[model samples]
Target chain A: MLDLSTIREGDSLPTVVKPPISRSTLALFAGGSGDHNPIHIDIDYAKQAGFDDVFAHGMLSMAYLGQLLTNWAPQQALRSYSVRFRAITHIGDEISCSGRVSEVFQENDEPRVRIELTAANQNGDVKLIGEAVIAVY
Target chain B: MIDRSNIGKSFPPYAVEVENHQLRLFAKAIGETNEVYTDEKAAAAQGYSALPAPPTFGFSLSLSKPNVFEAYEALGIDLSRLLHGEQKFDYIAPIHVGDVITLHEKITDIFEKPEKRLEFIVIQTSLVNQHNEHVGEMTNTLVIKN
Candidate 1:
């Protein structure tokens, strides 16, 4: 649990590194998310779509960022979260989800934290950029 | 060009039950070792009624709607050329396992940037629990390359 009393602007969140994605990971995600797009599961179809190989679903990476946020704070604290997919995540890419407190202020007499989030691969290529707002005590 | 006439149109609302096993699978897929996400006993110890749906779990629930592709087909979009551009979630309350949440989705907007060779179709979705309370709203932007 996050200690709202001690959190400060510019404080960095603990980084969460994901295991290297494999074909089975995407298939499991597809089963869970119900996103059975062939480009994500079929290498032949992905190549037909002019890609080198199958790619990870963008929402999967976003979910990793969500994991990062919820780990730091309670689920009830999350007010808003948004992410823009920046680049494709290939099947073997390892994503690292990280964030930092950008600002803290009062909204309607309640404390709120605005955080900037990023999911990047081992090669230092960013896959998604996002921002999240949460209500804190 | 996307069929702009579909803007403001809403799809049929559907209900999804948040299941613990699916939540555990998702947590595992994300490499989340947090017991509260996968263990009911741990979650109860943490003061939650049940294993809470991991953040973004709503996306999975929302997409599970059977009529999902019908929304894109309405706009004359070819599934092959579709790409996810962005996604946003507004969490108003905690959604837990066994909650029967209903998902309502609509085609909110459509725009194009000819110079960039892209067209965007934005869909806004809302989730309400059986209690008639708002759980969250999701904005999903899909891009079509020219």
Candidate 2:
């Protein structure tokens, strides 16, 4: 559980930087997530679709953001999580996931905290922006 | 153009059983090292009766239904041109391994941006466990390039 007493607005969660995305990782994610979209794994299909190469799935980044939250608190503590895909994450891009406490409030008499989250590549290009609410003790 | 008339259309409810190996594979694919997602003992330590599904695992469950792409086909969406625009999940309860989850899905909205030559489809799903408890809800927006 997240310790509400020890948290303050604006406090940052530890950042998680993943190794550069690789084709095998993308292939593995395709099977893992059951998203077999050719744009994400088949390079020839990607070229046929007007892209020069395959890109990472948006859900992959969202999953990384989920990992960031779970790293701070247990999974059951998560109340809600949402994300908007801002840009395509291409292969070879290293993703850095980060979050910060955005608000502290009570819902249904239970203390909760809202976190603003982000996933960006090594070049600092933001790929996804998201928010998560978690119950705090 | 997507048929706006499909908005509010509900699909047949489908059920999927949660499995431990699936969770482990998903955890590995996402590079998750959290034992709570992979080990029953660690999950018990966290007060879970069984291994807990990772936060985004529900998305995979929602797709587990046979003919998962039929909805898009009915919506006139060419899978080749589709992109995931956004996703949201509201957790009412934790989903655990061995739970049978039933999903109810519907088309909530459809719209187009002529200026960008883009079309958007919003689908909402409600998840209920075998015990008839609401466990989670998901909203998925898919964007199609014109």
Candidate 3:
């Protein structure tokens, strides 16, 4: 898990790789999570929905950020993390997941670390914007 | 066609707990091979209290709840026709192990087109703690087809 004593504000850890979004990723997200929205997996169905192509699941993108946090804190101990779906992530889009230590504080007698999180595509269009709170033990 | 009245109607309250093993299972299935999700030490080095739930972790928080769907079927809308129009959340705090979250649901909005056989219900859920601290809110538009 996460040890707060070792972290510092603006302390950037080893940069992680931002993977490319693939149709296969969407298929897996649909099958594994049971999301299965045609707009997210079938190109023809997506076109009918007014999309240019199949889009990645919004949760799949959010999952990337969660993966990033787990690297910082461990066994799904996150108190809470939230986001707004801003744009459609088309297949083959390159999404870069990045975060910066936005704040460190104390709440309810517990140490807390707040970070502003986001996933942006190669075109610099942001797909999601959100925050995560980690309670230090 | 789905009933217009059910558009803004919220079913009931439900809750789901985040378990460590389940978190690991999701991470592995999603191809999140990092130690932070799979190993405790990697998470510690990165500065975590434990294995962090993946960001979309909010889904697991409110996924399967007992009896709430009874209200959906009561409307006579086919469950399979429901499509998630969107999913969004706001993280107000961190959820640790043993944290049992209660989800309060409300139908925020509903729309029906005269020529369309479907109705859209804007479903909103607030995941709160026992003390009522807001944990997160999940909003999605469900398409109800006849």
Which candidate has the top score in TM-score? 2
Per-residue lDDT over A65-85 for candidate 3, one digit per residue giving the tens place of the 0 to 100 score = 766776676433455576666
Ranking by DockQ: 2, 1, 3
- C-alpha lDDT of candidate 2 relative to the true structure: 0.92
DockQ of candidate 3 is: 0.20
Write the residue-wise lDDT of candidate 1 on A1-137 in tens digits: 56679999999999989989999999998887778888999989988888889999999999889889877887778889999999999988999999999999888788899999999999999999999998887
List the candidates ranked by TM-score, beginning with the highest.
2, 1, 3
Off by over 4 Å in 1: none
Candidate 3 overall lDDT versus native? 0.68
Native RMSD of candidate 1 (Å): 1.4
- The segments of candidate 3 whose C-alpha lies over 4 angstroms from its true place after superposition are A1-6, A75-77, B1-8, B12-25, B35-55, B58-104, B108-122, B126-146
Candidate 3: C-alpha RMSD to true structure equals 6.3
Leading candidate by lDDT: 2
Candidate 1 — number of clashing residue pairs?
0
CAPRI class assigned to model 2: high
Query: Ten-residue segment with the worst summed lDDT in candidate 1 chain A?
Result: A69-78
User: Each candidate's interface RMSD, rounded to one decimal?
Assistant: 1.2, 0.8, 4.3
Q: Estimate, for each residue in B4-93, the C-alpha lDDT of model 1 and write its tens digit.
A: 888898987899998878887787777778888888898898788989987788888877777677767767887777899999998888
- Model 2 residue runs over 4 Å out of place are none
